[model samples]
Target: MLHRSGSGGPAVVFLPGAGLVGLDYLNMHNRVAELTTTVLYDRAGTGWSEAAVLPRTAAEVTDELLELLRAADVPGPYLLVGHSLGAAYARHLAQRFPGEVAGLLLLDPFHEDLHARVPQEVRDRLKELESQERPSPTEEQLRFGRSQMAPLFASWPETVRDQLIEHHLRVAWRAGLRESENVYDEVAEELRRAPALPDLPLIVITALGRDATQDQLWSERVLREIHCTTRALHADLASSVPRGEQRILDDAGHGFLHEDRPDAVLQAIADLLHRVEQ
Candidate 1:
């Protein structure tokens, strides 16, 4: 459920995106550990953690993380690295306990304002799909998914890579959808009502490349529109704080930015860490 490496204060903690386990970010975790203490952990219902009902509130998720850190005695003023849905929870934690956070590195994050930024037609389409019963991934679909993910894990240790690929193909693939089921509604409202984040170092990495999921869900025109809208959203987030900065990556997709461009993610974290120290 949790793993820690290295040793130092203002420890770096990785919050996995929906559907991803802590080990999914092992590549970056190992790299970060070389610099300072780093942690990788699964939320209550996801990854290797015990099962719980999905779609928990941001407060619930953040509180659970806090309790976990206390039990682990990892110390505070953490440098949080969060991707997608995990980024949302990181924002919640920073706002709720500003002093407990040192800085933040958000990757292709999901913001509360995203719903309003997206086109209405796309929203309607998403809602329609959500209303329908979700079908299980067939054998062909699983095989295709595995093939697509293989390259991302190629550099990882052989044993970890094999287990990760299998877990993702069989169960982790659905975790994101289940965890973010309330993202557009309750989750968004919760964030909107939350307190503002304190001044701190923040870096938002926006990945522009399209993945197979996007290709299957939208036309080329829509995908382009999405890219533009997402860039704008990330820019807005970066500008929200005085020290916040946005970095654009043309070569990586949303789900695998760390794998596709580990250098970029690591550099952002290093920059933020320096700023936090300052």
Candidate 2:
């Protein structure tokens, strides 16, 4: 895997959200590289990274991440930054490899319970991703596919919307299908039901203004993952770890790391890392 690393703080590892070609993290990675020892690696079979028979379980994903870290000489206690599906893997690794990870920065992540509780409307929106041909933007058949399926986001500015289009159009669609379908809910359950989380700093960014159908499910699942009843998942972290904080970014959607409020996103990461070292 190609590794992007440079900042001098503590090494931070980024896990991509089930898409090839991390055009999403490209800008943020370079920015963070200047702030800390940050490493953004394209997952196997994605971006310029070598392909692999991508693993199925969360444990397997964690192991592959370990391999990447070792290969890139990224020393641990790493601050793991994961978005969407990548959040599940990050939580799994944090729990499974307590000694190796120092903190977690989850950017509007998906929790498995949310999947089980998906309302028909949101579920319907996700269905097209499964049913249609996984077409490249080059193929005229999928030309308007992305624009037609805009329900995924509650709200977004033009730049963010454009990136979403690029992802649906330019990036490989098959990988997303594999991730959406094969990406199991069991991993979320494992993280949620853990008897006790390891003592590590955590910063969870939640996107608000969503309602009962999708919002309730996502909010509940994220809360359940932290095992908290508070407004933010970070509050729940204090119950498990010494230094933990949750910040709810009202405007940003699930993909906050690559969105317009990237400054806040990176600040959360820097805050988490600083929290641990102090």
Candidate 3:
């Protein structure tokens, strides 16, 4: 399950966050397609892709993506735009196959170093939250979610938007949770052991605003700690490579940064593409 658009070398690829399918990025994909070849696809077990076990390794995910690209005959060095968990896989791919990648644009990405970067209290609270049993969403909750998300995809074709909304409410959200079950343990360890990423054009976009869901899940103090630490971590990541840089978006939240500020996301992609070209 992949969709390719436009036509040009050094293709742009989008790696969606947990629970988000490639189509979720159609807005940016459409824009990038106008500039260069772009790809939108689902990883195994997510979106329209064939089902696989949840929480696969970074190595497994990276290999799958490489195979997908090869099978599809999309040429690379690719410019990868990854969000949240998808960003983790992008980093892994770049680390393992440096020459095949041109640049990386990470949006509010997850980092293996996150556990070590934050205070112990924050970790404890997060762990506690994770331990609590989560019930399925109630009917009311589903209705509310659909209403809130409908506007975001209002520009999309009606049929596609309706299907996406239903899929997200019924399946995608749960899959995202399952996929991230190993982030702190298995995923973190794999990244820690992986080789350092090669120097390349890289940009990390950090969103500081808190969304309603985030506010509901975390206390103000915890959220503040998260934002501060996340900014610091992103800055450090951006500085790790010769061409790395970080951009901050104070008005957008983590999950919907692309929707909230597509212009910023497009600018970051264009900037990285230019750097890669040079």
Which sections of candidate 2 miss by over 4 Å? 20-23, 120-170, 189-195, 209-242
Query: Can you list the residue pairs that collide in candidate 3?
Result: none
lDDT of 2 by residue, 38-119 (tens): 8766676655566666446677778888987887777788888888778778888888888888888876666655555544
Question: What does the lDDT come to for candidate 1?
Answer: 0.89
- Global CA lDDT computed for model 3: 0.91
160 Cα displacement, candidate 1 (Å)? 2.1
Sequence-dependent TM-score of model 2: 0.74
- Residue 228: error of model 2 in Å? 14
User: What overall lDDT goes with each candidate model?
Assistant: 0.89, 0.65, 0.91
Please give the range of 10 consecutive residues that has the lowest summed lDDT in model 1. 168-177
lDDT of 2: 0.65
The ten-residue window of minimal lDDT in model 3 covers: 210-219
Of candidate 2, the 10-residue stretch with the lowest lDDT total is 225-234
Kindly list the per-residue Cα lDDT of model 3 for residues 70-131, writing each as its tens digit: 99999999999999999999999999999989999999999888888777887887788778
